[model samples]
Target: MTDPCGACGARGCEELFHGLLALDHSRAEPWGPLHGVSVSCFLLQHPARLPADGGAAARGLLRAYLDGGLPAVDRLIGRARAANSHRVTGRSAPGGAVPPGREAPRGGFAVTVEEVAQDGTFPAAGFPDRVRAWAAATLEVWGPVSP
Candidate 1:
């Protein structure tokens, strides 16, 4: 789907800091060389206190996420398959089947974003930090999943 924010799908930390954040992101990108899989982490933010005109919209963010976000995510996860054909067929190596929940993210998982950077006022706080940590972990193939 096309991102309303032009490319990033959502805006940047500035928007997040101002509490004007909203996004429809899918996969930030998959990592790990092992039994690799795709994971999509969607982050949606409404005004912390809600604006006068946005109370209804803000109040319904979770519902929207549940009804729209989660279903879309599930569809994404369902449609998600191992990118490498060899891996899907186990032609790459020997491995047992995954139990469950070990696959792609189910419905919606929770992410806690504290303060990271800042908008010269509030701390960017956990948002940047978490994303950075995730990016690093991805590059290093953190946890190295077994097939």
Candidate 2:
């Protein structure tokens, strides 16, 4: 069936994809639904499922935009790199391998800032509003949200 909200729409989704692409494996996984729209974070975390570099870059930008800069952005980046990040993965049901097209659920990416850290402050200045504006722009480019 066609995606009810055209979940596969190519516009804003591209931005989202890019956002995912740029994310190093260290960021928080907000892999769940936010108001019915799914942010496919879990998919991006799997080595086999990671999007291409270009896509990853876009996703990185989106992620950076969303999560806000950490108090120590450079330090976090260093830690993540030094750790030699691992692709996140999870096993399927007992004795069940992951299905080809149905790996992780679709709703695991779109995290809010609070969910990503204990410190309740933004990284870059003027962040939260910027993210909101970015998301709104994406939604506008994609189409209006469904009721």
Candidate 3:
């Protein structure tokens, strides 16, 4: 029940989406950290969800990565923090600090950026390449993809 291209994993497609991929609420990565975030905006404005709630979730997610161990590989915190900052406040968090009350589950902290610019562009420079490297490492563990 692996992916047809062998990129996702040995698990079934349904399993990957429905059961797994919860982004580890525990933040204790006994296995490892995720490769990279899939850059896309989700509609959290539905009746069941609200923007404020979504903001909280964003901070929580950021906490996981900032405190997680998988980042020991490449530490893509600059871009990750920026992404989190913009998500939480619609403004930049200069230090990439996870918002108050949302502490990272792990003891480690994110690699802080010297400064954050308000140029309106989301990710910092070289983010896409970092994403690729993360993906490459992930795919290597999952197995090769087909042409």
Candidate 4:
């Protein structure tokens, strides 16, 4: 299905984006490398609040999804994906996956491994310092945004 929004069967992307829209401001984490592979971290935010127009669209989309609006957002997302892919380099961005043995994100298994960047491999002197640096960085980027 083709959509004006440019998605490609990635409901998680829309869900994450939608969650961002719900907040007044939001911050998304940078995708990081794990075991030599890039992995998306759980998105974090303060509170969902939106500007007037954005709020309206978010609400409408949320309602539609809750009301069984299927295939519609999928089309919009398709369009979005097409547009994004066209603009990006040949490398397709990796989407999220249900990591084996890890509980489903929606199944009360949402977890955040803070201070993970502090491992011995971290550029910092120690794990603690690296974790502090990571937290500081996260706050700096988010800038009081809900995400």
What's the lDDT for all of these models? 0.28, 0.32, 0.29, 0.29
Model 1: residues >4 Å from true position, as ranges? 1-48, 70-111, 115-147
lDDT for each residue of candidate 2 in 1-147, tens digit (9 for 90 to 100): 223212322224444444433432224333211211123222322224534431232233334433454333344345445555466344111111222443322322244222222133223344334344444343323222221
* Model 1 lowest lDDT segment of ten: 31-40
Q: Write the per-residue lDDT of candidate 1 for residues 116-147, one digit (tens) a residue.
A: 22332223334334443322332222122233
Name model 3 segments beyond 4 Å from true: 1-11, 35-69, 72-74, 83-147
Between candidates 1 and 3, name the one with more favorable lDDT.
Answer: 3
Top candidate when judged by lDDT against the true structure: 2
Model 4 residue 78 CA deviation (Å) reads 7.2
Report the lDDT of model 3 for residue 30.
Answer: 26
Worst 10 residues of 4 by lDDT: 31-40
Worst 10 residues of 2 by lDDT: 31-40
Clashes of 4: 24
Candidate 4 lDDT, 1-147, residue by residue in tens: 322212112224344433423331322222211111111122311112223232222322222222333344344346546767656665422222223353222211111122343221223234333323333332333222221
- Each candidate's number of clashing pairs is 9, 16, 0, 24
Q: What is the lDDT of residue 21 in candidate 1?
A: 25
